[model samples]
Target: MRITLHEVSKGRAGQALPSMSLEFHSGAVRFALAETEQRPTVLGLIASGRMKPDTGRVTIDDTANPKELRRRIALVDAPDVSDPHPDITLAGVVGEELMFAGVGATPLHARRWLTQLGYNELASTPIGNIDPAARVRILCELAVLRDGVDGVVLVAPDRHGGSPDGWWRIAGEFADRGYAMLVIIGGSAAVALERMQEFEAINASGPVQPLVLEAPADADADADAEPADEDAEPELSAAEPAEAAASGPWVAEAVEAPEPDPLEEEAEALREAQGPASSIEASDTDTDTDTTENGAAR
Candidate 1:
């Protein structure tokens, strides 16, 4: 399945945004490295099927009504539209989703699936108590469990301190099942992920261009600020010298690195078990080729 946007534009009469074209395809992973507002708006329009491109159109492979496409297309972590019921348990969330999709699976079935998926410990935990990444994974599974899901669009999934690698692993799992994955991000995270141009889109006109995210004005100013001299220290007033000398020699307090959160550690472990399929090029040697080749061979 594929979702294509041709010169899509939204917003005010003359101020339509993202005037660029985009496409998302099945069994592939793609990202939209855009601004905070731009990513969410475009994601909302695409996922909700309310997006009527002023100059272009969005089409699904075998579907006409975008609203009906909701069953096959899932949206995760989109701003203002992805909050699950906090009072529900993890299993309860799955059960509710199954019901929504008209699947007759019982809550016990949801529990079993969670256990098989290495989330047994969280099965009975309240959705509010679990990590947001876990919730997003559950939501994605909900889409996959439905009869005929084609793809899932994740909007700013990194917003809640969620792991990009974790979602990439989960997307990989679904992609293995022939489902497409669209990951949308903005700001620093978008810049960080801008290098992942391996996945191709159905409607791409040319080569994948590097996403150039500009630093905010204030951030650039801070970056360009001159550094202070190494030996320079602010001078105390002459009148306060005696007081400073009496005050125990200005001992510096040591700051300790914070202990890792157990919840996050468990989430990381779970994500690892799911298998990370994507790697950002942080070092000199290319890890993407290695990971992708290994994954493909498997």
Candidate 2:
């Protein structure tokens, strides 16, 4: 898959964003780190299929509907558990997402993905009960469920705080699988080096500004921004054994049972109370997590 951007800009709060352009091709992944003040709107555009060059054009090859294009390109970011069910288990969250994506209704696929991404033990644990790193891993699994996905895009504030090494291992696996990925992180030379070791490039952006520096000079300067290196390995540590178990080899277990569908239950209740409406009003809201520039919500 190929993603082409041309002078695409987004407006917010009555301000036109700075024009930006870029291209991402198959077999190559890009890494970018931007401050909250200078993040670009490219990710939002890509996620929403609203990427259009102000002076040129943005074309995606081999895609029909831009909305369905998400199936081929997965965007992973921090978990948003602000909804009513913060106590839902990781497995439950994955199941819900799969069902929403119309992939499958079984937990088996979710279990395998969580395991492959190294979050198997947390499969049955509520999302809010886990630490930040575990939550990030679950987010990654949720973003990239299908095997043949064209690309994976991830946004995070910082990777060094929890387990920098573990992040690299996972990113490396995605690269090895020929999945083009774009990771956004805070300014850190060490993090950039680690990402570039596996990714194709390390770009920069910010929240207030739409400019994206694809080829940043002074690569060493970013390294200075990293915190003092801790004894953390570039792999999962003993502190997170459940994470290890979650990423362990998949084991077939007896299927427990089935549960009631919440949507169906709601529909049933609605019917019981009153006759259903002729048609449900469709929502046009963009559901991509990358809708925001940097960490600031757009």
Local lDDT at 177 for model 2: 73
Task: Go through the candidates in order and give each one's C-alpha lDDT.
Answer: 0.69, 0.58
Count clashing residue pairs in model 2. Answer: 14
Off by over 4 Å in 2: 12-17, 37-42, 47-57, 62-68, 78-87, 101-118, 128-137, 146-148, 157-160, 189-298
lDDT of 1: 0.69
Q: How much does candidate 2 score in TM-score?
A: 0.48
lDDT of 2 by residue, 1-298 (tens): 7766565554563134445566665666555544443343344445335444234445567343665555576656432311215578888888887775568757898888677767788888887677655665566555666554677665552532555555655665666677676665566734655665554432333235568766566775775687855754345467876546455545234435689999999988988888665454466544544445567866
True lDDT of residue 194, candidate 2: 66
In model 2, what is the error at residue 229, expressed in angstroms? 52
Which candidate has the top score in lDDT?
1
Q: Let me know the TM-score candidate 1 reaches against the reference structure.
A: 0.57
| Tens digits of lDDT, candidate 1, 1-298 | 7777656666665254556667778878777765745556565556446556665566777355777667667776566666566778888877777786786569787878788778988988888777766766777877677676678887776666765667666667777778888877766766555433333233356766899999999999988999877766555677865546446445355435689999999999998898866566566775434545557732
